[model samples]
Target: MNIKITGSGSYIPNRIVANADFAQHVFLDEKGAPLTYSNEVVADKFRQITGIDERRYVESDLVTSDIAFFAAQRAIEDANIDPETLDYIIFAHNFGNVKAGAIQGDLVPSLAARVKHSLRIKNPKCVAYDILFGCPGWLEGVIQAQSYIKSGMAKRCLVIGAETLSRVVDPHDRDSMIYSDGAGASIIEGTDDEGGILAHETASYTYDEAYLLFFGNSYNKDHDEDIRYIKMYGRKIYEFALNRVPQAMKECLETSGIDIKDVTKILIHQANEKMDEAIVNRFYKLHDMVTPERVMPMSIHKLGNSSVATIPTLYDLMLKGQLDDQVLTKGDIVLFASVGAGMNINAIVYKI
Candidate 1:
């Protein structure tokens, strides 16, 4: 019983803030660099690094659901599925449209309303809600949806990763450069076709490492001030990556009963160029696996790090220009891997 991803879509804003333009808005240091030096260098090295050349952000008055609704509409159309058939609408987010309110916490309900309203989904009466867990949130949603569909709980599910990281990023920090606002949706439908989420495995190491990657000391002193904002011990997280990710990948491949050499493409979390290189190089050394040539280049040059959106967005990009060809033959394997701030690493095997 393989659940297949019938359609996948992403929502990017029309705004294209060039690196040069971003330089104008941000302050510079004595060395003629952005106050956080790394972002400055990233901007100088890559044209799209400083600002999303095509990023999406809702107006201050709008909500996350609004952005999600647009993306959901496209995804449903791409899937060629009627909205009336949707059984569940799972909204995933870490940050939302409105701040915590007295009545209903964040904007999850609004997200549901907007999606249903935009698509005019009726009859099956989709239930909507939010799920969040660091950057790995969407991957978890995929697994949950896969289970639900396989269990007969849903015939089709709209799984969304909607985030407004800009809300929490400390305007003063360099680390905040990695977080961005965007949404990605995958239409997972129950089918006899054998190409959905085949296998998934996660490994977590509880640590105060979260402290290294977050901020907000004055506002949330009671909680780890780090949790309130994005905080990262750059070198330390890199070290953790090199140590743990390979093992997780190895286990994922073994559990799927597929050799690494058999994988046609390895879709890694868009954490950073260095992390992807380390994992790709390690796997290549062990098993001659070719990281899909097209997606690898896009990771560094085209899309900066899009957090959870990276794997799915990259997968969508790779699927184009090739779906018509015979390169991705039946029985081929696609590997999806991601690591998040909770000191957790995950890898899922997809048989295409």
Candidate 2:
């Protein structure tokens, strides 16, 4: 059986925080001189690298569930399906409502209640749950739902990814200036097409590299929440991507009976502009394939790195005409891939 994405939706909070706006949070030097770390530098970094100039932040009143529900509503509307008909809902998000007592798993029942109340339907078997996988999450969620549909466990699935990176960011840190909030949703239905997930490959280099990048978590005292704020060896991450991602893509396509030329576009994780260019160039040299347009520039710059929501958010944005249009078409092959903090790299081949 084949699984197709029949609908898509995305949500960004109304509040927009520009790079310059970040300067207000910076500290001054001992000499009474403002630190050199200006929002201009951070914003310019995102703009030059990702082509993003602005990103949205959730208001203090909003949380992950609010974002997920809104995006899910749009996805249902786009698919022209009633919420009561959705057999299952896969909510992919690592960051939960910080205001709540627990993480995403604990927040699911409440979210489901809201959905049930809003749609005025009763779904005892609705089965809403959370999956954690950093930035490669949406694809993982898709793959997981494929299993349920293939087993006849469900007729339709709504996969939603909602993130509030700002919840984990250390507002006092310059690096935290880049992350913004956003969410996205997609409807996956079973099909007979053999082309859905033509190939998928996941690589985990578990070692010190696993500790190379981290999101701050204060709720736990064991890891010292103070150390939980975003921490990364920038140079290490860059080198790892240059060496690892290209090889991962090559392996995925080769096993799928797909040649580089067969691919119309590659939708990679939106880490940044530099990594995007590096992966594309490396892939071109490794497979002699022409790279498609860069789709994450505006997102990375404006939306910052949204973690797990990055890919789906970009997917929703591109389809909404926020990015290049010629890149996606029916029967065209597209590659979705991501590499993130877990030291995990996953790539999935899809057809438009």
Candidate 3:
């Protein structure tokens, strides 16, 4: 049995936040006093390091499920499938919808359930749930959907990755510059054709590296107060991705019996442009070859990193020819890879 991604859609917030926007808010020192740093300096440094000029943030009233609902509706329309026919709604997100004016995150209904509700899906048989796999959540959801289709248990599945990182990020922290809000969705269905997901690989290194990137939900000695925000050791994560991601991609390609040269595109997570480029370069080096310049498409410059939504959003943009000089055709081989907060890494090979 084969599973094919029949349709795809993505939604990014309308508000565009430039690097200079950070200057308006004041960051506090340990003494609860303002730490002075010019917005120009901060913005220049951010652009130099992350290659992000701007990113989008949802309106104050919007939640994770809200963006996901928009994306899912577009995907279902694209797939030309009835909402009632969907067997599963697999939503992936690290933080569920954070209510307006609320500091803490909430997931009482689960993002998947909320999306189903908003879609007005009345079929009780359509199971809905959520997956928390850091940035790999979206790919992991697809992998699970593949299992259901292969087992003859499901005919169609809606896999969505959505996040409002702006809600979870600490505006006082520099890491917040790399976070954004968006959602992407795909409709996967059982297919007799051979063109679809061919192979996949996933791994976790949660022992020591688990602390490398974490949410601060406790008192911070450095700040002399309680803090709950996304925190990360940038150097550690950069080193981890440079070392681990390429190997994971190579393993998936080898397992699928596909040659590196035959891959049409490499749609990696839009975390960092430089890191993603290096990972692809390193993957090709493993096969004693040079990386192709046009193979990897990127949107990090405009979208930043929306956690699990990165890859799916990029995939959808490419599918619709919204990306520069990129297009997919029948029988094209593509690779998808991501590494993030879980210290989790995943890769997948698919035929378009």
Candidate 4:
């Protein structure tokens, strides 16, 4: 039997934050000194590199679990499956529910449990849990669900990736412009039909790259050291991903036994526009061919980077015919890949 993603859903928050919104804000360097460039110059340079004109944010009353539930509810409906039949509910996220103005993440009960509770799934057989594998968390959750199906432990599963990064960003750090809130979910199950997941690969580069992306005190320096926000060495991460993600994708496609020519689409993590272009360009170079036109679909131009939610949200939008000129038909072979905070990378080859 093949493992297939039967249905999918995503929640892109309604609050749109444009690049121009940062005009009056103070952006500081790590040394607590102000950047020499004016706010317009800083935001413009950021757009040139990251290609983010705006991003979404959750309303003041919402949290990560709230959005996760919204996405899960839609996935269940899309699959037209009864919630009680689900054998597992796997949720992926970095920071848990960080309330408005809160400095801490609330993770007493797993986000999976909270979502299952919100979905009102009454079956006692449904096991729920959460995974923290950085930006690749949702794809990693899909990999885990495949394991359960292959091991006879589960036949149907709900995998979700969601985050409310707006609550965890440092206003003084320019990198804060790259994060936003969103959620995406899928229903995966064992199937006798043709299309399904074919192969997957993962890697961890923890020697020195572990701190490439980490939590740190605000750039303002006046913020308490005990109170930290998401921080990263942007240059280091771009270099690390360039050197690793493309190779990982090649190995995964090879393991699936699909020729490079048969691959139809590439759904990569939406971290930066320039970085993704470089990685895809390098992947084609490795295969000794030029990149194909319209093979990759992107949401970062408007949605920014929602970590684990990027790929799923992009896929959802594609299926709904929201992305112009990007389409996937039956028998299409697609590659799903991401690189993020563990300094981690993962890729999967799937037949649609």
Better of 1 and 3 by lDDT: 3
- Candidate number with greatest lDDT: 4
Error of 4 at 110 (Å): 0.8
TM-score of each: 0.79, 0.84, 0.94, 0.99
Model 4 TM-score, 2 decimals: 0.99
Q: Which candidate tops TM-score?
A: 4
Worst lDDT run of 10 residues, candidate 4, spans 320-329
lDDT of 1 by residue, 76-107 (tens): 88899988888888776655564422112366
- lDDT digits (tens) for residues 1-352 of candidate 2: 6778888898878888777776566533323344566656665674776555667888887777888888888888888987788787887776556652223234645453554455565777877767766677777788777778889999899888778877766555555655778888899887675456677888778776787777545322333443555656667988998899889888988887887777877778777777878887788888665565552233576677777778887878776777644335578787888887778788888876
What tens-digit string does per-residue lDDT give for candidate 4 at 218-330? Answer: 99988898998999999999989999999999999999999999999999999999999999999989999999998888889999999989988888888777777787777
Tens digit per residue, CA lDDT, model 3, 1-352: 6789999999989999988788786555434455576767777877877899999999998999999999999999999999999999999999788876677788988889999999999999999999989999999999999989888889999999999998877666666889999999999998788789999999999888888888774223354245477888888999998999999999999999998889999999988777788889999999999888789888989889999999999999989999888878889999999998879999999999
Residue 41 shift from truth in candidate 3, angstroms:
2.4
- By TM-score: ranked, best first: 4, 3, 2, 1
Greater lDDT among 1 and 2 belongs to 2
Model 4 segments more than 4 A misplaced: none
